[model samples]
Target chain A: MTPVLQIKNLQVSYYTDAGRARALDGVDLTLTAGEKLGLVGESGSGKSTMALAMMRMIKPPGRIEGGQVIVDGTDLMTLSEQTMLKARLSKIAYIPQGAMNSLNPVTRIGAQMVDAIKAHDEGSSRADIDRRCKLALESVDLSSSVFKMYAHELSGGMKQRACIAISILLKPKVIIADEPTSALDVVTQRQVMETIDRVQKQIGAAVILIGHDMGLMAQFVDKVAVMYTGRIMELSSVRDMFTDPKHPYAQALIRSLPNLENKGVFNGIPGMAPALLQLPGGCAFHPRCSKVMENCKTQRPPSTNISGGRILECHLYSEKA
Target chain B: MIKLIIRRLLFLITVIWAASTIVFFIPRISQKNPVRERFATLAISGGFSPKDLEVIIASYNTKFGLDKPLFEQYTDYLSSISRFDLGVSYNKYPRTVLELIMDSLPWTIVLLLVTTVLSFVIGNLLGAIAAWPRAPRWLRTFATPFILLQGVPPVLMGVLLLFFIGFKLKLAPLGGAYSTGVIPDWSSLTFIWDVVWHQILPGLALLLGSVGGWTLSMRGMGITIQGEDYVNFAEHKGLGGYTIFKDYYLRNALLPQATGLALALGGVVVSAIVIESQFGLPGIGRVLDAAIRSNDFLVIYGVVLFVTIAVATLMVLMEFIYPLLDPRIRNE
Candidate 1:
């Protein structure tokens, strides 16, 4: 079956005073129907850039240099702005990071929801829009009374759930949730994640959960992709990723997570991710890798496929392959 | 909500009462005496006997309630005010203060209300257009002149407009509400047109001097509102440019401007003073000016009391209406 979303060799850059920063460098990702994929990385690893690029909403000084954001079969880059806008809510929905500040404070939730619905389908009657809005709110376990309330009236958790409800209102094929639970408390985070999972199941849409919490990613996503310095260092099934991380960065990230069972001292990755403006000549992670070799400093590592559909972009894996 | 309004109304009454009391005592505390000043020329001419002068002074004192003790006079003043009886004017004797006010109030209201509302609407529209992210670069450049114009005082603007537009171009009448021969008749179109024609220069002066600040404030607000996350959410929701502009951008940007509008409306009386005097219009400003010159304490107190009540009422009204516009304020 065709994937719900496919991003091929996507490249994005930010034009700053210092120089052009390669925010997203030749990244490729695909998600099949109802698949939950987690993108984990440190700050400035281009995870958020990738999410924005998928929506084609990059502002000035930030440009999508080259890419094909294929939602089902449509190439979003080639579509006109007007067409892209129409395609956004109907085909691909984005739940942005900050739920606390998302909705317009002056407008009622119901009015704003109706605005989104009417933007695509202007012919929709008020009763029809109200029915759908009520259903969407109920799906998130929110009462219909919240529809008349403003964003400030809702708690952080409720706002996040409302945002999720809005994202799935049109039942788009792909829902890109960028750090959806980062701002909530632990309990609220779990509840919101459960709601997202339930809603995704109900809608049968693919999910791209972007976050930095390795533990949460391990529990939530079916597949996990580790990103570093604008490059995906490793991609594997969550079970394999947690038990046996192939790339050194992935291993370091997992090692840093405190394990109650073993009670070993947490070890963090040495050195920082390379600055995108002046990236290292060869492998971007070479300077921080303990298993680095001379070839790692002079040449870029190609992706080598391991057993069980796992892929690793490291010289150590390349030699074995 | 009713409780809030009631509290605001009580606060407004206290403010107005304090202002009225201060206005009533200012001329009395000053050394200048209306009765003595009005007869200064007669005394200098030495045309009356000492006995005749004594009788005139006594009658003037009785008429103005100066013969009574200060406390009794104050109570009388307050009681009369409660009864809506503003005393007769000292300068324009035989004419009550209320009648004089009634004559000039409509002209000032027309001039101020028209100019203020027009400037606010035009200025905010231009400012929003200039601040829109997709607006052409040249559109922003148009705001520079208006920004500079904000520094020009309204009185100076009125004089400049009187000199250039009224005197040099001769496009409008120089001063007064209408031509000397035009009778004040409601049924005559010519009379009404003549009055409006006379108001053009002064009105334009007020508009030009005030529109700049509104534009600057609204531009700042619009730019800030554009950075809000709801704008991005609106975009992701497939909202059209117009929908985002109206619903997200303008709606949020208008909150501060609404407060500014209320404050500006309250200050209309203060602004009208300079514009009215400079244009030589027979408005409240001119009446107050004459009262001050002749030391007509009753007239001065009456006009100031009217302005105080107007401003206080407007402020209270704004306090009640503000929550309806901004939801964030409602909970607070």
Candidate 2:
């Protein structure tokens, strides 16, 4: 499969009165066309930051320090600000984290969708744009009548689906859905996830599904990238990840999930994720890693590649390699 | 919506009735007789003797129906007000209060309405721009001076403007509604231009003083709205800065500001009184001022009633218009 989106050593930092917070610390990720990558991490593991930095939507105090976000063979970092704007929602669209408020409340859903299309492709006829927008709405399991509704008029599931419809309006090459199913119930969450899954397949767009729900991630994603302190600790097929995880952090994360075998018995990873402002030397997860060696506290391990295209970043994996 | 309108209108009538009744009795509490007060000011100037003044006052009271019992006069006042017959002005003899208000109403309405609207537009635009993160530095600078000017009351601004623009610079007329000797003709463009020109200074005072308030409020609202998830998502949708600012940013921010505009329009009477009197424009403010000094109780009642009705009606109109601006309010 051709890689539709590639992040090379992506680094993002937030300048503050206290100190610079390295949000995305030399992060690297790749998602091929039509593939779903579940990015599972605890809160503030740079999941949302990575999404924003890809779109270059980071507000002030937070800056994309350096990175190459190459989508469909085009290096987005090299594009001019004007071209970057056109590139967004056309080349790489972002379905925002807060689906509840991701749409303009004062405008009609059809208007919001139409405006997005207009912003990107201005030469299209009004009728054509209307048809496409309505079609996009319908594809997300919403009626074409939803086009005339306001954000407040829709249910939580409908709003999320509406956001998904908007993201697919331009048939973007890469769709980054940042926690789209949050603030939804289990049934609504499954529905929203299914809508996203169906839409991604229809558009042939790679999707980076960011969430902390291991169960939901297990069901929807073909592959999983376990993140810790702004870096992916392991990336592997979902089968190997749940069956035989490599990285100690990924193992801990998987073990932390509630299973039928561990009924009413919760197993949480010890210690907290390190602060971005002052990450521990070597591996940022060294403080919490159960399989830490003496060298693990001094030497940050490189990403070790194994058979079947799996990746693990840890002293144990590299020592074995 | 029809139910809401009817409910609001009924509430409005209750408020107006309460206000009219209070206005009727408040002036009556004073011991001063309108006829005697009117003649005293005229006599001081006319050099009239007081030999038959008491008998003349009694006869005048009888003629004006002021000799009736308090409850009887109140019922008569209410009945006459219900018919929209504001009694004749004691100060301006034989001229009805409604007639005086009508003659002066147009001037105040035009000046106040134009100034209020101009300031609202300028202020909201400048304010929204000022708060916009992507707006050019120079475009944002326009709001600061207005915010600073908000501290200077419109009445004071009028005095300063009159002194500089009128007296010192001679850019416009010193005072009054039109050029001293021009006959008022609605058909003549020059007369209208002259009237507008004469109003420039007072208009400026009102505009400069008021635009800041709108800018401040709008800027504050814009700050909140621009940071909303929808606005950020609009950017993520790759919308141009102008589209985001106008549709996503300004449209949402202007919701509360629109309501503020209604209240601003309603509250302009105090400013109108100072502005119209200072500029010597023949607006209701000046007429009301004259009536108050002469204790022309009926004319005072008439002006108060007019202002109350205008304010109450505008508030109701604002309520009906609000849901159109904010969709969330529509269902509620």
Candidate of highest lDDT: 2
TM-score of 1: 0.95
Q: Write the per-residue lDDT of candidate 1 for residues B1-332, one digit (tens) a residue.
A: 67777788789878977988888787877767688777875567765446577688789889788888888988899989878888998767899999999999998888998999999998897788779887778877677788788899888888888888888998888898889877799789988898888898989988898889999999999999898888888898888999999999999999999889988987877788888888889999888988988899889989998888887887787877888988888854
lDDT of 2 by residue, A94-206 (tens): 88888888889899999999999999888999999999999999999999999999999999899989998999999999999888887899999999999999999999999
Query: Which regions in candidate 2 have their CA more than 4 angstroms from the true location?
Result: none
Docking class of predicted structure 2:
high
lDDT: worst 10-residue window of model 2 chain A: A283-292
- Output the number of the DockQ-best candidate: 2
Candidate 1 chain A, poorest ten consecutive residues by summed lDDT: A259-268
Q: Write the per-residue lDDT of candidate 2 for residues B1-332, one digit (tens) a residue.
A: 67887899899999899999999888888868999987887789898858988999999999988999989989999999999888899988898888899999999999999999999999999999999888899989999999999999767898899899889999988889898888899899999999889988989999999999999999999999988889988999999998998899999899888888888877899998899988899999999899888788899999999999999999998888888888888854
Chain A TM-score across all models, in listed order: 0.97, 0.98
